[model samples]
Target: MDMLPVDRTNAECWQLGTDQITVLTTCAQTSGQIFAVEIRMPPGGGPPVLHRHDPSEVYYVLEGEFTFYVGGEGGVTRHRAGVGDVVPLDGGTPHTVRNESDADAVAFAVHTPGAVMEGFTRAAAVLGAPGARPTMEEVLALADAHGIEMLGPVPAQL
Candidate 1:
């Protein structure tokens, strides 16, 4: 219920596939209200599948550009995001944020329920070593356990 100041130097860092995830605030730290992680993604880095989770999320782009694909009542919309762009993703909407550029990208992935990021990053750690890509079967299993529903494969964008 007090100010939880986290120093960047002391924050825990982990690797999920090619992503460098620095957990700034955790679900336990905030009493399950919010969880946030800073993600450093390389070019061509992101999930291979379009997934939907229960917690609504926000992506604040700090560096580089990302192609955001989100599904709505009509259809999927492709958004080209760059530095300082903020994207709001609703809970239960299928989406994926990908760094399709030649350079790296950095952003804060903030989730309302917090369990989404917490479960995902921890699962990635258990799945394998840093930067290890999980197979489709493994991904499916993880998603199933974590309340995530896989919609389909990530589509190609221009």
Candidate 2:
């Protein structure tokens, strides 16, 4: 199969939580081999929950500072990453990321054998919209459909 090229101007952008995520490559575009997204986060922006999935994820911090929390059911480890830092999370490793600084942050995230993250991100964008509140049951269902499991809420400091 031939792969087509994609650029920022042609990518699909979504609002997930407080971040603007631009999907660069999707599973469908890569025949299920990989998926990538560029995320722009304002100060204190991040995912609503700490979660885990089957696909391994890598993050390249392009700008600003981000705090990453990674662990399992037992505990978590926190790391503060700045520009040019690369962070990798193994499959099924629970993790969450946030922009704790006063400045905005940009990061490129890639998932190998990209499961259903593309779909999940799209759905989350809609669900996270203003006044579009979804129940916990619905959120859990959505995550489950995408092979993700939410372990806890996002940290207060984030």
Candidate 3:
């Protein structure tokens, strides 16, 4: 049996947002269904530009409240999640989540088919500086850079 933990710092961790990221699993060694931990907007942290993945995802809230933007949604929805809240996601639709509270918003995400996180980081770097907010154009560029073809223009900002 595999008797070792994957070191997160050694994994391909990257900042997809000014305060968000794709942290590789430190204990799972990419085992099971859990692949990474996505922490978005620390206490008082800002939200990331809207985006989505080609694979399915799950956002299990670990603390604080946040706003969720699911694809085709009429308006933003506010969900106060604590240690036990889970938000499931399918790859078909686009979505973005933001911390609307004064505390950190932690979530664990499982991605089927490992290495997509690495692709996100590489794409982010090519399209925009890591740890920085990306513009709509930049996001489109990043998507293209990562081999994810753009289907339509970015939604108009509210």
Candidate 4:
């Protein structure tokens, strides 16, 4: 069994956005599943592009407000998930979750076995630098390299 101290304060506890940090409690090496804890984000923080996985996922909001966009060719459903709210997502469902509030938002997400959180994290790092945002071509290139499948362009509202 792997044993890691909880007090270890490292940057790994956070990820993506300049103001947000995502602590990973279960990485592929840890729990054999893609699971992580996401910490606060500023209002209108950027959301991930529309993408789908080969496995399912579930998200539980712990604090603040969040909007989950589950979309398809037909339409999109924006779920306003608050504390204690749980959003379960199935494979082949292109979706994204974002913070739409001024306060910090936190959530715990569990992607199924072999999901691409690590790759997502890596790609985010590569495309997450300051100044200009990465182009769609660049984003797809990174996602492709990481085994992620992009469904379409980023949502219009993002």
List runs of model 3 lying over 4 Å from the truth.
Answer: 1-3, 9-12, 20-22, 26-34, 43-49, 72-78, 125-136, 147-158
Higher-ranked by TM-score: 1 or 2 = 1
Best by TM-score: 1
Measured on C-alpha atoms, candidate 2 has an lDDT of 0.86
Better of 1 and 2 by lDDT: 2
Mind giving the per-residue lDDT tens digits that candidate 4 earns over 43-109?
7764556677666778888888888888867677677899999999887788877777887777777
In candidate 4, the residue pairs with backbone N, CA or C atoms under 3 Å apart (3 or more residues apart, or in different chains) clash, namely 14-21, 14-22, 15-22
Q: Which of 1 and 4 is ahead in TM-score?
A: 1
Q: By the TM-score metric, which is better: model 2 or model 3? A: 2
Q: Model 2 misses residue 134 by how many Å?
A: 2.0
Question: What TM-scores do the predictions have?
Answer: 0.91, 0.88, 0.65, 0.76
Per-prediction backbone clash count: 0, 0, 1, 3
Model 1 agreement with the true structure over 62-101: per-residue lDDT tens digits: 9999888888886778888899999999899899878899
lDDT of 3 by residue, 108-150 (tens): 7666544554566556755556456668887776576654544
Query: What local lDDT score does residue 31 receive in model 4, on the 0 to 100 scale?
Result: 62
Query: Candidate 1, 89: how far from true, in Å?
Result: 0.6
lDDT value, candidate 1, whole model: 0.84
Relative to the true structure, candidate 2 reaches a TM of: 0.88
